[model samples]
Target: MESEQALESEAEQGERLGWWHHSHPTFAGITGFFAGMLFVTALPGAFAGLLRLLLDYETAEKLFPFVLLALALPIAMLVKRKTRRFAQFMFVGMVVTALVVLGVASLVLYFMVDA
Candidate 1:
């Protein structure tokens, strides 16, 4: 009975503090923040690149920012369903996305500087 009560109260505390995935609030918030950052930084550029390369579209870059909501909605829904899973997926996704974006950006910079 005592353990059950403690668990109940702990859950209540988490609810009060905006904890997700039944873990502490801070960790969830930090993961979500970085995930959002990755979405903003990489996803649009990725979409633009695909459109340009695969579809042979010249003006797709101008529309990349508009797809921000399209990219974010699925992740938001996944978080709503399961926070821990969201955090795990987002952690990996963010790292990969950031690396790709940075790698391309660096290559572009290198070419510009060399020229």
Candidate 2:
């Protein structure tokens, strides 16, 4: 009787803590958003750095267009029903981040040129 009671209590505790093991509902969206931001910012810089390390400037510049192939992964994710929601959030993040960066950059350039 004592052993059975202890086992039941453990099972109840496990059930209570099970949600801790699983991600929250927003986890996917938040993760996808940050991932998209990083993909836009860091991925290109890292890719360029790697290319420069391995090849000359002329060769790396010629090969840089190949980076567009990375778009296929997100396109594939968007096509799949299971990943569509995360992919959508990722796209939103990418577009917003890009717009903000470009807007600030252009504003700064305009001010500098005007001055």
Candidate 3:
């Protein structure tokens, strides 16, 4: 029911969904790191003693910023070189790291919750 101009405007707004849109290179890495951290950190006692109570939900929300920082710093250091390679490496590393973390966390959760 919308006019052509309205449809065009909506498409433009959709494209501007900011840094984490799939079209953005870092989106995968950014999401992966946090997802991995969440899995590993979800165990009730995992971070309590060592982190001394920094494992709360509010603190967990900071994971995204931390991952972004991790990805950005390394890329910035190599910005003058082959950026595509750097991006690929960082994104893949982030994804792999997340998968490993998630696997471990799931195992832990499975044991803890089931038993």
- Candidate 1 global lDDT: 0.69
What is candidate 3's lDDT per residue for 24-91, written digit by digit as tens?
77665565455444433453234344344557666665543443444455456346554444444555
Residue 37 lDDT in candidate 1: 65
All candidates in order of lDDT, best leading: 2, 1, 3
* Residue 7 C-alpha lDDT in model 3: 95
Query: What's each prediction's TM-score?
Result: 0.41, 0.81, 0.35
Q: Write the per-residue lDDT of candidate 1 for residues 1-115, one digit (tens) a residue.
A: 9999999999988798765555665665666757756775767768777777865454675655677566557455566656655555565666676787799999999999999
Error of 1 at 69 (Å): 4.5
Model 3 TM-score, 2 decimals? 0.35
TM-score attained by model 1: 0.41
Q: List the residue pairs that clash in candidate 2.
A: none
Top candidate (lDDT) = 2
User: Candidate 3: lDDT of 84?
Assistant: 46
| Residue 79, model 2, lDDT | 95
Tens digits of per-residue lDDT for model 2 on 36-61?
Answer: 89879988888899999999999999
lDDT for model 3 comes to 0.57
lDDT of each: 0.69, 0.87, 0.57
